[model samples]
Target: MSAHVFLHLCHEVGTSLEVGTRRDIMDIINTLANQMRTNLMMTSGSRREGFRLVESDLDVMYWPNSYRVIWELYQSHYYNNLSKELILCDGSESRPGFTLLYLLSPRLYSELQRACVRMKNRHYISSSKHRQIKCSAESQRSTLHGPCVGRHHGMLGYDLAHCFASDIWPPSASSWIDRSHSWPPSHIVDDIVKRGCHFVAIGHKLEKHEQNEWRISFSLAEQKLVYAMNHFQFLTYGLLKLILNRIINNGLGDDDKLLCSYHMKTAVFWAIQQNIIPQWCPHNLLYSSLTCFKLILKWVYEGICPNFFIPSNNMFLSNIYGEAQNFLFIRLYELYKMGIQSMLETLSITSCNECIDFIRDPSISSCADEDVLFSEADFDIKLFREVDNQGSFSVSNVQKCIQFLHIIEQMIASPLTQNQDIMLQKLTNSVLQNLAFMLPLNTYTQENKLKYRADKISCHFLKFAAKFGCISDVLYLAMYYYKTFRYTEALAIIEVIKVKLSQPYVMHNFNVDEEMYTEAVGGQSWSTKMGQAVAWNIKLNNNILYISELRPEQQSSLQNDVPYLYIPPFVMLYMLEIFAANM
Candidate 1:
């Protein structure tokens, strides 16, 4: 292909406006949902930032609301006394963008105390101790990777980092404010500064007290900056990551960790901010990518990949020196000399042949259709899992239910596209299902009048959810009826679910019975088919507030930290029918 055609193909494949918008919508919804949780505030990274790369891990940072990190002593006054434990950032001994956290709270919680060590009559939280505790507290299958505890079981493995929230931006990164004048614009910069940063449980590797120091995290700020990027710039960033993972870091062992996704991100940030590429557009996509690559090569050559926020903090201080640095530099230099065509050809030869095919033809092929269906299935499964993962509603209090209702209302009031609307429908279904269970559990009273009213309301909520939910979700309503001693009503819903499951188009997990699905709804729009498609699995979130009735039978499943129980619709239908008959 000619250079013009190749660049156009690259832009078409990587810089998809539709894909970017969908990702933005997903992020907004997730961010809103995460904000409702009181105990731990979760912020999504990587994939949530509008890139739908298959290799991207689900990166999340969560911090408890009870603890607060402050830059200055005076900032403590803004927090309510006894409400939150204050941790002061002491950057004196640590490197720029890393700080020693001094426990400013008069009474340290046992967990905090355990992670703290006294130095000069003041207790400082040990990063190593804190990270150990956090990692150990997670599932045994999780492996510790720097500040994150990673679980590698699902379609998309996730890395969970436990961090401390700082309301004030770190002084070390204060230079970032002045540096963002050209690219991010004043409003974006102001928003990032106001949102501040986090302190993750990993210190500067070269620091003397590395165990007691916390590296400043710009995850939130970085996310904002990414959101601010135009499609061309975003795709350029994605292309760099593709090079890093597929070309640079390919076949490198765990210990041979040299270049990281962050390095690529920092390079992109600097490139955009510095206006190294005068115009970032489809025609200049390859040029932009090469510019970023050149910058990274220079950094690798110098053995100094500077942190974008704090340029003084050399990210390559720990590694990327001597033999490793030389190897990386040579590899990058060879690729650079070979030019963009060589790199594209190299990518085409990789296992991800679909990427090149996608570049060549932007239109959805038959295989792409199947992939899209599977992607939608995965998205739905993830949405279901996130609902279950959020702190469950207590049987005694319906506060969480109320909060979810508020969130649902907010989502409805906002303007949404068809895809987002469908997502909202699914979200509404999940929330209402949980609320249905919670209402019955919390309002169950001996007063016949009140009990009857609550039961009626609960049933109505379940019915509403059933309208928007998958075929399997209707079983929730059936289960609710069975639980309430209304066996006949339950059996009726079970019969409906049985009929729906018999349909050839019903999807289950990632398994796409393509021939059957195509025959059923081949000509229909994706949104139409998506609306009609029913999942085979009846997902009961393993939360006592939602599934208290199932506790007796699901004792083992509940005891473990599994988010949801995926029972086949047929099995649930039959089981509920048998139970209703016996009753």
Candidate 2:
């Protein structure tokens, strides 16, 4: 496990696609994506960004753009009143910034459903149900021997991401609401916005519920970040992902979906943000990787993994359980201690599964003997459930809220089905009972403003339930509050939730340690301003100097260490100082 050997291995495994083959693959993927799009009338595009020669396989983002298409169909139903089944509830009127549409008519509903199925079949090439083309032995041959037809090189090897590309800014961006603070460069933000962020279709028990919401993905930004990395940084990331996907995840068990490449990507992002860039040299690659492992382990230990762009969006909100979280933390911590020596051992024992053939020969290989198509659908689709996790209300209340949500969803969609009246009545009755069970008793006097506020909040909740068919938003908002250390505000929001849903929440109370949070975040003026915005929705006053704009004298005042729960201390200081020195 000498430096020479490790470096050589890194070079061997982490090489990018050869010039010709890279071009060919891109052409094939784009052509196939376009064909599917033209034939299906849906948006489809593929980008090869995260692929590493022998280390990683063809990592493509198969964007289905389902929400946009469905949204158009929904608009048609709303304007035409095509069927009684397609009921549209304008949440914008009742609630300021939301909209929900119900699929009521079973016949028309079936049509939309059929369209969705078609989209799934045409774009969602991984699903067993949609693999009707595989029924014939002749069709299977195309997957086997053909130069352009192997799954790995062919169009079929891609992981389909049935996501929606939307122009909406992430809710976490609200932290930068105050004009006084300097945020990520305006140009960068503008570029991200122009490219448009995507939201993947993800939820728990999504099939049974009508409202399957989207989870924001900065994959486009992620690709950019990867590209921006130096050679060592790129190689380090590829190596870490290899360890996580092969050694650690395999050790956990085959069915364990707890850890994945995205988690590793998140760790890398955080590391870069923390000024670990300089540390990611060939000489220190192992150390930098250890830092990444430590960061992820810390997240696992705390049972919270912050989304790099969205501070409030916890990536591990739904996946990590009590036993699982503990096990993963211990395992990762051990790996970090073992360092490169352990990595060398793992690499030696583990099969070299990287796409070496695709890189060296530039020839498409087939997996004809394979019984199953390995896809990321399972991990890619589960959106983090919004739950008031910071001990605001009882977990049972939260669970009840989620249950009531399904009832409300069914109630709303019932009218669109054949048994409209009967189903609606039954669902309505069931919803009322659940609501009664969940909502607080009317105790305030008429003179009390609390009573009126409660009524208003209740109205908003009911309307929202009708729209989205769930109270997950309430949970997510509460979590956001908790993450920002606004415990009181978080509890206040939770109290307004008129449902008894139960789930795991942060047991510990958040202390508004302003200094700690600011230091951890880095960029003094921006950090202070962001804190102010979170505490009180103040206008973003342009009063502070970002690290990039800081003078030598100002650098002395930069918070070098922060105690924020999300990112480690000193990271902010490192980032600020590094930027200042470079500038």
Candidate 3:
């Protein structure tokens, strides 16, 4: 194909995330990260680098300080029991959150017989569901199969990950490949070293312990590369992901898990390492993307996709076999020949839907009353000198809180009207009063800060959307602003709502729920059905009914002893009510 045609196709596939959508994603991530500080951590891919297309996942990591604490407990009782196995804490009885990893030597695995004896004595009485004992051998080699997980709206899901910190790399260097002064800018390098690298245990086995190895991951390094990319280079990576997901992967069927977007990423990394930057100019975006595809094909043919930092560690070594590799190579070749036409056909519907949704979501628009936002808002609030600390919050109380939130959500979601102002005021006052009453029930982490005053954080976020007026969600945006003391930003969102009436605000996507199903059944039809049933039951029981914990398997990997990060529902509703009243 000629250069013009390729670049045109690149433009079509290289759609970047919209400004508002990007901000919303970041804000959601920040809120979650802050709330779950003791359990989960957050990061981004295409969303952060600005070259995101229709197909991208918001990847994050889950690691509580408790994981480290539990590991230390086992470490303290180290001994050469003929079984050589270290009793990593059992996570079987925990809630669905994150997995507990156990590092075992060959000698230990044999003696432990896939079972750990309960420790005889302990200094402290344990409250965590995980036991102080050895674990059975995992049914699958991949950590994702065993314990690696994330939760969304009470459902469990999977996202890409590696270790948080590694022992092999230079502690000071920014990027993983610190030697010889390679491609990424100096600033990028500095960031990598500061953030550090993680290790992924590959080829974990029950019978052959010697086969296991630690693969050094340069995920942080790759993110730096994407961020540092010129506009054209960003397009190149987006096109590559499109090709992998639509062409090669679709050909392998939905059940196929081999050759993910990460493999394509490593191929691009390898090309850059070989000094292919000159060929990766803006005009040659499609050409560069094609070149990376060829690199992937070469690796697939040889049954080896090298880790960018640690070349000896092959990423595709276990994920694919000869038949699968050959099949993928052939499919990718077919896609290369089809070229721009194939991408246009494959991405048309998905891209169009994304654009349509981006325009629909209101969190992107400002709700300022005039052209500018106000410096201060005047909402009636009765500050209490003493809190109403009550009995232990029961399931019924939580159900009531959820009911109130749902009611407010429906009211805000309805179309705007002239008389709605008085109703909003009353609703806000009522919510605040109830929230004040519930405040004492929440066990505050710190008594000094007003931020710690509310137990359920989401309550402070109750938003009201008005036609050509400031929205309730904007009020939520205001709450975060108020907490950070950015009153101007908060007022700006509030003011915009007063100016122009617009379409009803779209609900935030609970995309993670779908991911939870995918992880539960590993994407098989029969098991997927089973997983759906299990998920529905869990959601009904844990969320709608407020009567249960996660499923045993789901709970096995994710639950922890760390106090729950989220504020109780009552506190969240109260805060949202107050926010709406002031707006």
- Could you give the C-alpha RMSD of every candidate to the true structure, in order shown? 5.5, 26.7, 17.1
Instruction: Order candidates by lDDT, high to low.
Output: 1, 2, 3
Put down candidate 1 lDDT per residue, 1-583, tens digits, no spaces: 2233334343333335444545645665665657576656555666667655656756778787889999899998999967888999888877778888988864645677888888979989888898899889988878899888997432347888988897887887888887777989898888888888888899877878887889888888888888888867877887787777777777888787688888889999999999899997756768898899999999999998889999999999888888978998898899998887667666532225555565566573323111233333444444333332332322234676667678768877887765566566666677677777766454445587867787877889888877766667788888887787778988888777777777776665435566676677566653445445646466565654343446765566655545566677677778889888998
Q: Best candidate per TM-score, number?
A: 1
Score residue 79 of candidate 2 by CA lDDT. Answer: 37
Full candidate order by TM-score, most accurate first: 1, 3, 2
| lDDT tens readout by residue for model 2, 1-583 | 2233333444344333221223333333343234424222121222244343433444334443323312333354433343223322222221111223233332433323432322212222112221222222223333321111223321224233433444444444444323212323466556665564554443322222213323445666665555556656666676776777667876555467688777887788677766754655555766777778878888999998876676655767666858878887888778777765556556642234333332234354433211122112211111100011110111134345455446445545533422232223323332332343234424434576865565445445544433332222233334323433445655665555422222122111121333433344334332122222111111111112211232342434323211111211123223333333333
Please tell me which model should have the higher TM-score, number 1 or number 3.
1
Where is model 3 poorest over a 10-residue stretch in terms of lDDT? 378-387
lDDT of each: 0.72, 0.41, 0.41
Which candidate has the highest lDDT of all? 1
